[model samples]
Target chain A: MSRIQSVLQALKGQGRKALIPYITAGDPHPDRTVELMHTLVEAGADIIELGVPFSDPMADGPVIQLACERALEHGTSLRQVLEMVKTFRSRDDKTAIVLMGYLNPVEAMGYEAFSDAAKAAGVDGVLTVDLPPEEAEDVAPLFAERGLDPIFLLAPTTTEDRIRAISQHSSGYIYYVSLKGVTGSAQLDVDDVAEKVSRIHALTSVPVGVGFGIRNAETAAAVGRVSDGVIVGSVLVDTIAKNQDDIEALKSSLVNLLKPMREALDELAS
Target chain B: MSVKLTEEMLRALPDTRGHFGAYGGRFVSETLMDSLMQLETEYLKLRDNPEFQATFDKDLADYVGRPSPLYFAERLTRETGGAQIWLKREDLNHTGAHKVNNTIGQALLASFLGKKRVIAETGAGQHGVATATVCARLGLECHVFMGSEDVKRQSLNVYRMKLLGAEVHAVESGTKTLKDAMNEAMRDWVTNVDETFYIIGTVAGPHPYPMLVRDFQAVIGRETRRQSLEQAGRLPDALVACVGGGSNAIGLFYPFLTDESVAMYGVEAGGLGLSSGQHAAPLCAGRPGVLHGNRTYLMEDENGQIAGTHSVSAGLDYPGVGPEHSWLKDVGRAQYVSVTDDEALDGFRKLTRVEGIMPALESAHAVAYATKLAASMDKDQMVVINVSGRGDKDIHTIAQLDGIEI
Candidate 1:
């Protein structure tokens, strides 16, 4: 089974939704990146999403934007992130890793080169925030050829036709945007997200992960109840940004918040 | 100057991969490769379609006020006492600059592609105002990214864009200049690629844009050809224009490129001095490097960090020149020259006094070169210079420098 499928199966057996945490690579420091990755994995993170710092990130919220800025200041590049991921896979091969970011860095690195490097680094999937399913022609094929799944997002504005298209082209899990605006905007509608997640579940057999606005434990637990996985971005990014000098503290705080939410999700599943 | 561009020659000009004599080609992100290939295919199809040509031509004529006049600057010519000087009045284009000529054509193409919004990055705000104007006319949402420094320097343009219903985003990243604004705009394009149309301002950037913008701006040269024949009955001895990303220069030079008899000169902004490391003369001092979206002559330090460029005119303050201009400079098709800020200011004041025409600070560089060229040539020799824009918007800077109240 695929790493994503294995994670979903593990979640099913434990009767708990997956807790996905996102961290911008090299945010605190590139030297501590492998440590943070392992810490997050140990902190109840079923899957870890790594952000590749870009010069300009328009779609990202303030929290992640700050993280990216810090990472860029420390000279974090897609290549550096790949190297970190390779080190990460040296000790832990079971944890699924997804590289989440814009397409420019990947494009600059060349799609085929990036896919090959990512696979060598044990990257399980990719989630380019900007690349839509229609434009994913070359990118999706490159990833699939290298045994890496290309994850796509389905938003509230997506129609049934688009959902079908996204599901057909997508591998790993589908990212369901919980809100209409950017990542940290406070306009997330729980009922609206739940309804959309249910509709998306009916269409795709792949696991559906909800993201974009789950900032706190309450929201994470709420989203976990309806979706196969809960992906928290800005909150975790903010944690790293605030405690950049201390990765252990940041990781512990993230785990402390996610542990109960994962238990709450397990209760719902039971 | 009366030479007509045959369909075959135009096809032969930009060879198979869009290279214009070692100038234009795709040097960009690998992800953009497929998109650019698709765009090249679409552009070639649209190029041959008479219907597309008719629509583009109509917009150029009616909307942009094309066939911009070729006015004889009799007084300025007499002052120079060397050549009879003429001005190709691109300043009279609908949005008060040569920028609109490309925007209108691109907006129409955007509509044809079923795009809902138009996005662009601007340095001097001329391109922003022009893009906003076309978007408003077409009832499409317009988003313009201007560097934070540009927003502060060109506040009136910011207000003008807002008045035209464009969302003027003040980008406060990087060096807070045109290059950074372009970076943000590219990010936006990548995010909204399916629905947004990026209307690049100049004859620069990666493939499709440099070639596409040149095609749209070529009207200036085509009209100059007809007007020069109507008035002087012969081609001018020299074609001079300022190069800021080389859009206007390319527009005015492309039609006369094969006219070996006609000399071509592009003026670069020599802010303080070229050796002082405070000038925007990329062709003069820069090496080839990839920037924004294309490989071009870019001003960079040994570390490859984008170096700071200096120019009195915010419009001309860029670290890179258009790739085509770099090629033209190398291949000897065009001569690249520089004018100091002091000379440009003198030219600005001279044109305002002698010709009753105030040129943009960016255009002053060309005017400065023209004044020198005319003074050095024979009295009967003809010279045509592209007055790229009106200077009304720059009065504040001119006034401040002269210690005059706003």
Candidate 2:
């Protein structure tokens, strides 16, 4: 089994929800990404979502957008991000890392090359923000051949037919955007998310991880009740934005913010 | 050598998923998929309905002043002393630009879809003004997204859109240009999909949009074909049009795809020069990548980040071109070239002084290329250029560049 599937399956067997934290690769600085990934794992992240910074992140709200800008300013590329993942793998092998971003960089690198490079770098999965099922038919198989789980997004506006199609092709986990708008949008209704996530779960066997609009422990706990995983993004990036000048403070604050959510999610599982 | 494309074959392109030969597809977020699919279905139904066609036709004839003259440029011809030059005067259309053609068609579609609000993104404001005008006429709320830098440069257009009862939002995102405005507009559409209809002003974006915009603007080429047969006694040997998102160029080139004898040329904005790295000439210097929901040639770095693009003309300051243009370029059906800012300026001045017609800076790129092309061709051959917009909106920019206040 792939790393993501093994990790998710193990978590399911333990009756505990997966905690996934998303941070833009090379944000603040390129050298600090490996350290942050380890910190996220230490803070109870079962699957680490490392964002490949894009110039235009349409699916993201202001917090992640600013993170991307910071990462780009520091000269972060898809290749550099893979190198960071490779460095992270040098000491650790249990934490599953998923590279999340838009599809242009992958297209630029070509599918076969990217899949091979990702597998070599120990990337367990990939979530392309703009690539829907209709566009993923060509690249999905390439990823599967490399044993990389092709993750997809399910939103409030996604239709049942589309959910069926997306879920059929997706593996590892499905990211259910908790709100109708972009990431960091405020108005995450826990009841709405619960309803949609259940519907998604009925259609596919892949674990559903709720993301977008998850800001704190309460929301994470609420989502963890209805989901197989709770994925946090903007809050962690927002914390980094605040402590950009102090790397030590940024790492500490990220851990501080994630720990409560981890405990809360664990409590629900228990 | 290019294959002879039939009218029927060309019209049947962009099969169901909106793929224009591996270029165009619906690459949007899942939230916007249902809306786009609904739009495509609605468009297919309305595209063949006679009543819908009649209304669009009526609007083009009565409201937009169709059949804009195909005038022979006697002075420009004499100066070049090669190909006989003709101008398809799209500048004569309502709003003084070809952008109104697509806006009118989309506004009608929006009304037919029962959408209460209409949103558009613009760079030069001609499209924003045209969209606002149609929304005011149709009694729908209108909003236009523009780059903050464009808002500062084209303040007059911003005021014009507001005066026409549209909300003008200045997008402060990446590079603060047309691409950023489009990104913001897409975000807004995803949030308010039920009530809002996004009227993309160019022949780019996701599927159906490129095909739809090209269909709306094809009136230019259709009219030119008839007018050329009447005045020149034959189809012009060559066709030239400026390309930003490639609306005007594709509009003029679509109807002539089967005309194997007619050569086509698309002019891109060369801000300074090809080597300067500060230009919007993607077809000439950039590579293909997925951006703004389509696979097209874009000004991007090795890491696939969209590069900062520059152009003297606000309308042509985009980092990517339409996917159809990309297909056309790869198929050798058309040749893409670039014109420097100074050369386009000279074309602007020459046309005003010689033919007594002022052209927009965006259109001036075609004019500049036409001059160079005309000088190299035989005198007996004929060339027709789509004068996509008038120069009134660009006076402030021209004056500023000339070191004078308006």
Candidate 3:
């Protein structure tokens, strides 16, 4: 089993839901990324979704877009991002690291080379925001061959047919965009998500993780009740955005923000 | 994204799923895919519906002032001293540019789809003006997203868009250019997909958009074909047009794609020069990559980050070209070239002085290339150049370039 599948399955056996927190690599600085990854794991993150910043993040709202700008301003390259993953893997071997971003950087690297590099870096999964199942016919298997879980995102607007198609190609988890808008949108309804997740579960056996708007502990716990995982992105990135000048504050803020949500998810099983 | 195309394949291009030989595909987030598919379905159904065609036709003819004249540039031909040159006067169209052709067709489609809100993104603001003009006439709520830089530079067209009753949003993210404006517009559409119809101004963007915008603008080629036969007694030997996101060029070049005898050239802005790494000539200098919902040639750095693009013409200052143009370039059907900013300025002056016509800076790239190309051809041969827009919107930029306050 892949690291992501192992983590998700292990969590399921323990009657616990996965807490996935996303942070843009190189946001505060390149040196702080591996530390941040370790921080996320220490704060009870089951899987780390690290954003590889691109110049144009089309699916993102203002928060992540600004995060990308900050990351790119720090001269963060895709190759550098891979090295950060490698560094984090040195200290933590069990926690899964999923790289989430657009497809161009990997496209520039060539799929085979990127797959090799990602595998070498101990990356567990990749969820490209722009690459749906239709375009990943040739690219997904390359990553899967190296045991990297090829994750996919399904939106609230996605039809049943599309959900089935996406789940068939996806391996680690399906990121159900809980709202109709871009990342950082705040209109997520847990009941709507529950209905969508149940329908998705009926369609495929792949675990479903809900992302895009799980901002606080209540929402995370509410969403975790219906999902195998809850992904929190903008809120964490917004914290970094709020503390650009202070690195210690950023790490502690991430810990403080994530610890409560982690407890909330554990509280659900209790 | 690089798929080879034979002559037969070119005719049936983009296939059903919008693959122009692997260049065009729906590279969008899942939230917008349904809307894109719906737009494509509606567009395909309307394409064959005679009543829908008639409505689009009527709107173009009456509202947009169709059949924009194809006049022979007599003095320009004599000065060039080679081929006889003819100008397709897209500049004479309503809203002072060829952008209205697509806006009218899309607005009509939006109305047919019962979408009351229309959204668009503009670079130089000509498309914004054109879209706003049609939205006002059709009684749809128009919202235009423009880059903060463009909104400041192209203040005239921004004001025109406002006067036409459209809300002009100044996008402040990502260098605040056309590409950034497009991102903002995509976010808006994704947010309001149920009620909004995004009318992309260029023959870029994802699957349906490249094909849809090209079809609407193809009237330029259809008219040029008829006028070539009428005025020159045959089709012109060559076709030339400026390629910003390649809408006007595709509009003028699509009908002639199968014509083996007719050579096509797409002129790109050579801001300083191609070697300077400052120009916006993707087909000429860049490599193929996926961007803006399609796989196309883009000016990107080694890490696949889209590099900043430059041009005297704001419309052409984009990192990527239309996927159709990328396909054509790969298949050897069309030749893409660039003219420097200085040469484009000369072309601007030559047209104004010789033909008494002021062409937009974007179109001046075509004019500059066509002038040089006409010099090499035989005197008996004929060339057609698409004057894609009027130059009034560019007057302020020209004045600023000359260090004049206007």
Best by DockQ: 3
Candidate 2 residues lying further than 4 Å off, grouped into runs, are none
Q: For candidate 3, write residues B1-110 as lDDT tens digits.
A: 23333468665888887888768888899899989998999999999999999999988898888999999999999999999999999999999999999999999899
lDDT of 3 by residue, A1-270 (tens): 999999999999999999999999999789888988888898899999999999999999999999999999999999999999999888899999999999889889989999999999999999898887888877877887898888988888899998888888989998889998888999888899999999999999999999988898999999999999999999999999898789889889999989999999999898
Q: Candidate 3: deviation at residue B94, Å?
A: 0.4
Which parts of model 3 have CA positions greater than 4 angstroms off? B1-8
Chain B TM-score in each of the candidates? 0.96, 0.99, 0.98
Error of 2 at B404 (Å): 1.1
Task: Please give, as one word, the docking class of candidate 3.
Answer: high
lDDT of 1 by residue, A1-270 (tens): 679778888887877788888888888788888888887877778889888876555556567767777887787888889999999999999889999987657766778988999999889989876566644666788887788988887776677876887799888899887765566766678999899999998998888999877877788878988889998778777777777777678778777766776667667777
For residues B327-395, write the lDDT of model 2, one tens digit per residue.
889888999999999999999999999999999999999999998999899999999999999998889
Candidate 2 residue B146 Cα shift, in angstroms, is: 0.8
Clashing pairs in 1: B82-B378
Model 1 chain B: lowest-lDDT 10 consecutive positions: B26-35
**Sorted on lDDT, highest at the top, how do the candidates line up?**
2, 3, 1
Clashing residue pairs in candidate 3, if any?
none
